[model samples]
Target: MVRISSFGVGGKHKSTKFALYCVGLFGLALLVDLLWASSNSSPSIYQSIVSQENVVFPSFAQIKEEDKKKKDGIDKKRVLADNFADLDAPVLNWEKMANAPVPRLDGAAIQIKDQLFVFAGYGTIDYVHSHVDIYNFTDNTWGGRFDMPKEMAHSHLGMVTDGRYIYIVTGQYGPQCRGPTAQTFTLDTVTKKWRDLPPLPVPRYAPATQLWRGRLHVMGGSRENRHTPGTEHWSIAVKDGKALEKEWRSEIPIPRGGPHRACIVYNDRLYVIGGQEGDFMAKPGSPIFKCSRRNEIVFGDVYMLDDDMKWTSLPPMPKPDSHIEFAWAFVNKNSVVIVGGTTEKHPETKKMTLIGEIFHFEFDTQKWSVIGKLPYRVKTTLVGFWKGWLYFTSGQRDKGPEDPSPRKVLGETWRTKLEL
Candidate 1:
């Protein structure tokens, strides 16, 4: 080989050229990476999950201490609240309007085309709310009351809409309303007409109802009594505003049901809440079971049924309260608000419970925190939305002899804005 370098000077000069070439290559590679990232518009900040040890439940005293810290001008808690708050902070000042009508609980509610429709709930042995109330957001009107084909009570049954027709799922019927019903019906919101649909295979009341991927998902709910909850699931596909008769598909199983009254569609998983494990006989004279003194021990368990039709148990609720009738609502795409429910011994004769607390679940972090308690313990239906603000309505409170009409139902509505 012909020698290109004679001694140390030439060798050192070659090394310098190699070093500059390596540096130039690195610079060119970085520039290309920056251009690719810019072209793809990738976010500068990427979310990463850090492994965390299992969290311990907060005691009442610990909760009080945290609240104190939040209220004591501590910037950490305040800033955390603002950062993790639901509903965008920009639209926190939106005006809220109420559509007051008759008091109703255990009714079905859904929003379609920016309008909310409520229908079919029970009141007393002799009274029931069969009239459907429609609230139009665009017009700010609330006067489309239609009657249901039948009345139901204490039933955990739910209703959903395909934007045109309302599908009323299985529920309890008869006086006292403890009878198991397999009947399914649909009401045309446009025509104000009702039609019977094929009944569910098994009789269930209050299975968490949600629309999953253009199909209906009914999760855990009570069967004969509240203690005997069913874990069977059902899915139905509707085309042309009508359910396809041949499209009912059985999906995954859920955890046991308890008077389950709350379910919502999020990330294609149905999150079920507040199921009962005791006897709940809405029937006139059905035998009540004595499983435990805690008549209404709310389930602290949170199960997420994913898109693959598999159920995953997320972190449990912070507390337990069974009678949280319709207490689940999606506040946004990534958060949900589980509102007030009942904890019982029946306050009268020292066997009553009335709890008024609200819990919020942050889906992204799988964390739960207590927001605040309600003015009073409530036992009623809950469904609403976070249209830049959280709007909830229509629940019942504790009953008394003077107001003893099976707890005069609530037509009251509330709005809370999340600072975030």
Candidate 2:
């Protein structure tokens, strides 16, 4: 190297050389930037895991608690008026059908052609299940067990179908809302095989999930342990013909409450009804509200999420709605139906009694009424409407205040055709 202070090399030449050197350095930096961007860009948030844990039965304590509640079998002479609450309720026209091959609840179900695929949920304290059972309507029986990639869920797992493929999103791996998993999976209804998609930005349990306009919309549920952090919504873009793209985006969280059991979409609008919103129970002296019990504070808040993704809190569950659980559905665009999960209070007896009451809500008028009563007092059951019948599967019935014994988790399945 030669000193340039004395202008040994021509002054102008030195300046030009320095300028060229700077340009070369800039080009090198640009090349590295392009390479990094290319390498980091990916289509999905998740990769794949080969081996996952198998779902075991619930904890021993829960099993013992359930055993205390279990009855020998269904009692044939069971009558609603004689055994349960709701003195003025009319009997609902439904009967026992067939028992589920596997006992599962709080899972997801989708009817594809003749097969009703029910997956995840707790099996034995809240033992997460890895197997998916397919109920064939044609044969009136269940098909072979479809094993999932992993074992997880109890109570809340996000599931929905596009009449093509079934999508299962986040949920707690173990029961008790502790192990929230982030991965998303899909099954081709025709092929009956499982495939992994992108992972959730954050793991969550009990978040409500549904398929809308070729995209998977997941919202609400517990972000932390059992504490719900208000209304948060996220969506992943899925293409037509059972294809999921690599795009996921955040949606406007609901203004107030979140979904408890499930969210129903009607007339391009989303409705959250009869969901467990808050963790706190009613105050000691505060009168228990409708759908909400003294300690088990539930909400019948009819929150509607419009096309603009805005939420409208409509009529809360019927005052004395009493059905603080999540087994609710819409008969059509005009009317809503709530079944199974219900309870009633008797002022004369001064006690809360468990009852299987069928309730109705009107969307246009925002009104609620007692339509009928389920034969057996049941709660947390799965309801699916197909053909002309509303099919209910696998739920527990508890002895009301009349009996303080632990409630039962049952595998009883039944169906009733809705005339309305």
Candidate 3:
């Protein structure tokens, strides 16, 4: 019998031990890498792994942090809030006229030649009207009514007017918490008839509309309760005496669901103000989601998209507001005013908020300033420049008791004449 004593196998045993040590180290490295990859294996990571068969790749864990940032949905091309740091200069004082109309909000107004055409708005809880409220600056009168072909009770829809026609886009028509139709309607100043246009590709409300190069441009709004929608642009075109043709185009998508009431067109660039989030739909008997049960407003960041379709972040509004159905308007060619919109309460109250702040940004100065407030306690106030005055019309004040409770969608009117 060959006796193999404990210390008898000299050099050969030493070599075997060294080999074992090296194998153990290799195993440890492999184990560490497997654990790392397992920890970082998302669906994308797995897809990558499945594609690589024999290659010893770096652990997914090692690169996971970097991948998460790259995978984020935030827009790199769009500039957002904070670009308006240089926009704090005082606004050029425009003349102010208070002897206008009754205090109200959430109405549509337009400009025709030298006149401001004010139309439908809600007055109190459960009251959405279709009164075509008109304001004549030359005559200094408030109660002139044009009969609309069909009455619409909506808030936060895009309200725009060419020198010849007035257009009302998608908006919420019922109570403060209700949703509006996704329809487009226009009023011919000459014919005084309401004609429906091609409906939006999707149903939405609270979008921004402005006239650019004779084309009526519309952007932003909520689609099915989601605000950060990808669909962002549409326009209307008319040829001399031909019927109006509606054309829909896509611009660079906004970062999220809305441009909301924070949209204005100045010097051809579109300035989108703060927007809101959460569900605003009112299904007949469905229970409201807890998150949507109360007001859940969003960022105060201001953003501007120039004609070149480039987005630049602007300094935030002095005060943050969201879901303000009527919180955005052009105070003048050089300023933007945001009116009755709130961020704290879901079913926004009828407690009138006169803090209707105006943000005046001069294109020449590239600055912003908070100017005056709207006259009446209001919500979703739409402003149109006509005959050298700003028209405020139609919106909800006090919402009703329950989801479908009686609430007012007003139809009154007011006017603001700037001193600039």
lDDT of prediction 3:
0.56
- Range of the 10 consecutive residues with the lowest summed lDDT in candidate 3: 78-87
Best by TM-score: 2
lDDT per residue for candidate 2 within 275-377, as digits (tens), equals 5544322233433311223323445566788777678878775432322223655567588677765343343353434446677777778787876766666
Better of 1 and 2 by TM-score: 2
- Per-residue lDDT of 1-420 in model 1, one digit per residue for the tens? 866657778889899999999999998797667544533542222112112655233344644554575477555534533322222212223344674576666666777666777766655544556667876655556777766775333345666766687777887664244566877777777788777766777777677777667776776677765456677888887644567765457877776666655676666567776556655444444454212332454566777877576778888766555545456666667887776665434333434344455678888898987766554456664556646555556767756422211355687666566543
TM-score of model 2 (CA atoms): 0.67
Cα lDDT for residue 252, candidate 2: 88
lDDT of each: 0.61, 0.61, 0.56
Instruction: Give lDDT for model 2.
Output: 0.61
Q: Give the per-residue lDDT digits (tens) of candidate 3, residues 1-420.
A: 978876767868898999999999999898777656654744344445554456355465646654664589533223222221112333333443443354344555665654666655544434444657566656656656666545354445677666577777776655444655767777777667777776666666667666666666677676756333434676666432223665566657765556355556677776667766544445446453211342345556767777677778877756555544344555466665555454333223422222344555566676656656544334455555554565655555343322212244454556656654
Clashing residue pairs in candidate 2, if any? 58-124, 58-125, 59-125, 300-317
On the 0 to 100 scale, the lDDT of residue 142 in model 1 is 71
Candidate rank order under TM-score: 2, 1, 3
Q: At residue 347, what lDDT does model 2 achieve?
A: 35
Worst 10 residues of 2 by lDDT: 42-51
Model 3 residue runs over 4 Å out of place are 1-105, 151-153, 173-179, 226-231, 239-247, 283-292, 322-333, 336-354, 373-377, 382-420
